[model samples]
Target: MEIHKKFAHSILLLFVVLATSQYSCQAQNSPQDYVDAHNAARAQVQVGPIAWDDNVAAFAQSYANQRIGDCNLVHSGNKQYGENIAWGTDLTGQAAVDMWVSEKPNYDYSSNSCVGGSQCLHYTQVVWRNSVRLGCASVQCSNGSWFVTCNYDPPGNYIDQRPY
Candidate 1:
């Protein structure tokens, strides 16, 4: 009986160790997680060799911000003037026309040049309340300062028809 108990105990210990090791190994850190950790550590001391994912995300965000800023410039305030009227406090027939005209030019990317390997362009259009799409007002780069045009039909077609 004593020998049997010892063998059982050893088997249990071995199982526990194996399970723990498997769990730890399966909980690998993602690329984004590594980037965040490295950036946080760099706040205290200089770190070398930044991850590629971090660079790509940063570049994408910067390009998006630039496009949004430009559109907001003409549509921030005074709805009846520029692109703001579509989703602003005013929605006149003339305002709708102006919106379409604004979207017809380079504001829509029909022929984008940023379609390559690691240096491709991605666009995120403005959507309202998880529904109505506000269309694309600009194209942004994920790794460089390259951009294209973007827009949708009927210009600023908002299903909710409200600007928040």
Candidate 2:
């Protein structure tokens, strides 16, 4: 009898935890917002020689701060924006907010050159293209809010490929 009671209590606790987690996910988040956060975060964490999924959902929640629960993906305060990573497409905010290197084009892997020479270029392209199923968020309500800034490593482009 004692074992049965313990099992019941354990199950009850598990149920409560699941319910609370789901409620938390919905309370402060919308579907699009969740998708955005997951994608962006996945990119950031993915480059560190390790692949992670646990933090993806949490990373996607911040976009909820800018959106309303309406199905149209509009936000109550459209003044704010969310940015995503290169391979992310969950539509958290606008493409303008992303922390990408603007000087390079998004069409190819050259925009995001790889480390230790261009060997990673082809591989990066494949990975990037394959991971773009999330699609883009088509809104930029945070117009002119960001102070555009850029930094380039002068001596870094030591390769022989230059338009002379």
Maximum-TM-score candidate: 1
- Model 1 alpha-carbon miss at residue 160, Å: 47
Alpha carbon lDDT of each predicted model: 0.32, 0.33
lDDT of 1 by residue, 1-164 (tens): 99999999999999999898644432322344333432343333232323323333344334335654232222322222112222222222233323433332222234332233322111111211121212222222333222222222223333334211
Candidate 1 deviant stretches above 4 angstroms: 28-35, 42-164
- Taking all chains together, the TM-score of candidate 2 against the true structure is 0.23
Candidate with top lDDT is 2
Q: Give the TM-score of candidate 1.
A: 0.24
User: Residue 109, candidate 1: how far off, in angstroms?
Assistant: 38
lDDT of 1 at 84: 24
Model 1 — which ten-residue stretch has the worst lDDT? 120-129
TM-score of each: 0.24, 0.23
